[model samples]
Target: MRLNKTQYVALHLLMIFTFPSYPPYLIVAYYKPELVACSIPSAFQGQAQIKWSKAMITVNVLTIIPYALTALIIRSRKTSSFSRRLFRSLLLVMIFDVGSWLAAVSFIKLL
Candidate 1:
């Protein structure tokens, strides 16, 4: 389905905030678990906690790239249909994610 400019912008807004929004809350709750604070429950315990923490930290740090790219796409003079824009944005993020993942693994293996 084709979307107009408004829908295209909305798509960008949603994409920027979707998965990237989760880490902030998890970070807050994990760090500041009080009666008034949010709790992350016992599911994230022991080694699981460590792995999850690392993944969360990595995700939060890496999310900035896509956010910047989306903002650029939104503000760019070049106009494209919603599906094409969405596909390009998603493809860019996916390529970045995979490349970074491989790089991290390779770096870790060397160490």
Candidate 2:
């Protein structure tokens, strides 16, 4: 199903909320225990608010296209080779990278 601009907007907003795989925060939490406080890490200087927005913007801008494709593939009825190829690749990532499991489910739910 082709998404019109409004659908695309909705999809993107949904994706933005879902796509920031937990690894980054987890790493910071586990490895940098000192930074565990909600306060911004001094090294990451400047306001916490801007940093959060930047991370969200960076993740969505970089990943939205591939993620959209993944969602489309999951939602599609066809069993095309391209879909198999793309999904298989994603499955491989999902297999190797534990962090991606949530993303895989989120994409599936986009249908």
Candidate 3:
């Protein structure tokens, strides 16, 4: 099944709004332990900060690029079985993406 232009536009809009912005925030929370009230010993904090920053940057780039590409593909006029499958996969990914962020945020708040 192929989506109409309006559906395409709507999907892209939804994706733009729903994509995760948590990796950067996670990076901050991990590095600035004060933000999340982490009580780690001072000796390892510097190493932890470096590791978190690197991991966050890597994951953020990885997640964001595919997200942008998926949005672009959804917006295009090309309709094929592959595109449909890709669109469904993207939708599922977005669902998981949003769910994961919400879960993490709640978990952090509870900590």
Candidate 4:
């Protein structure tokens, strides 16, 4: 399905809340842990926070493999009713991807 301008806008806004995968933040968290505590809620002030933050981001980075592959398949294929169905399924996958990683992050915070 070809997305019209409005549909694209709506999809974008909807995706915005899905805990964005920002590489720069992960970089700062890895190289300069103190700096990220203010920006990253789970990253508090401590040496352990640095390790946990890096591990959480690492898991998040790994999860992107699946998300990217699904996205590439969707984009490489022609838009059609089938693609729309795939897009819908992709949204579900996206939700699960982000949710699972965040859950893992939360779990790590407890450790």
lDDT of each: 0.62, 0.55, 0.60, 0.64
Work out the TM-score per prediction: 0.32, 0.28, 0.37, 0.35
- Give the clashing residue pairs of candidate 2, or none: none
Candidate 2 deviant stretches above 4 angstroms: 1-42, 48-53, 56-65, 73-77, 91-111
lDDT of 4 by residue, 16-94 (tens): 6543544344545545434442345444445545655676577667767877777777778866878768777877877
Q: Record all residue pairs in model 1 with backbone atoms less than 3 Å apart, i.e. clashing.
A: none
Instruction: Give per-residue CA lDDT, model 2, range 16-98, as digits (tens).
Output: 67655543554454353244334223323235434554564465455556766776767786777887788778766644554
Better of 1 and 3 by lDDT: 1
Q: List the candidate numbers ranked by lDDT, top first.
A: 4, 1, 3, 2
Clashes of each: 0, 0, 0, 0
In angstroms, how far off is 60's CA in candidate 4?
A: 1.0
Sort the candidates on TM-score, descending order.
3, 4, 1, 2
Q: Which candidate number has the best lDDT?
A: 4
Which 10 residues in a row give candidate 1 its minimum summed lDDT?
A: 34-43
Put down candidate 1 lDDT per residue, 21-111, tens digits, no spaces: 6555554545634343133333343454455557755765676677667657766845568755785777677768867765764554355
Q: Candidate 4 — what's its lDDT?
A: 0.64
C-alpha displacement of 106 in model 4, angstroms? 12
Error of 1 at 77 (Å): 24
Among all windows of 10 consecutive residues in model 4, the one with the lowest summed lDDT is 32-41
